[model samples]
Target: MTTQKALIVGASGGIGQNLVQYLSEQEAWKIVGLSRSQPPLKSTAQFIAVDLLKRDDVVTKLEKLTDITHIFYTAFYGGPTFSVPVAENLAMLTNVVEAIEPVAPLLERIVLIQGGKVYGRQIGPFKTPAKGFAEK
Candidate 1:
């Protein structure tokens, strides 16, 4: 049986941390976590300290992980203004993808994790339940 390897970016955040814990319990699954700080919990997963903002650093750190089967991208960078965070977050995701694509030939999927902010909750309040399409 082939083992599934998961590379989780932003492994220290709430969602990322939870994922690490969950994946660690599954059989035939290997976990590799990347974050600026170490996650609080102890697990079998290997952790790598990486600054997603630095392209060179990300490339240098992640180039050798050739066995990764899936990439769970949960990293986020916040700023005083909205635009700054948007650009920086995109750059972070790009760095991870560019670095891993060439080295990890077995790569199958890249999962992007997004939260409630997509509904503009950060800006202000909206309806009780959000809908995919706007009401006419």
Candidate 2:
């Protein structure tokens, strides 16, 4: 039997933390955790302290993981986390996706954690679509 390797992009987060705990015991996965602020965790996972906002840095780091079989992208930003526009946010995500483009060929799945904002976090009629999302 072969063990699968997973790259988790939000190691310090609530969901990311929980994932590490669960996958650690599976014995079928070699976990690689990515985060800017890493909290205390008990898992036999390779944890990397990275800030995905820096595209080059992130790309360089992820380039080393060519055998990754899955990606758990649970990274998020709220409050004072990001200062870019909505389109930029989407672009940032797109850039991150691009970083994994090569490695993704071997991946079975890429799970990105999204919430209500998927409907429309920001809505405007400025030569674009309208109907913003309601606050949670």
The models' CA-based lDDT, in order, is 0.88, 0.73
TM-score of each: 0.88, 0.75
Off by over 4 Å in 1: 82-84, 128-136
Could you tell me which 10 consecutive residues in candidate 1 have the lowest summed lDDT?
127-136
lDDT of 1 by residue, 1-136 (tens): 6799999999998889999999999888899999998988888899999999999999999998999999999887866754336678789999999999999999999999966564556676779676422233
Q: Residues 1-136, candidate 2: write the lDDT tens digits.
A: 7899998877788788999999999989899998886669989999877667788877887887888888888776653432324654565466567787776577788888753343444332232343334323
RMSD for each of the candidates = 2.8, 6.1
List candidate 2 stretches off by more than 4 Å. 81-92, 115-136
Clashing pairs in 1: none
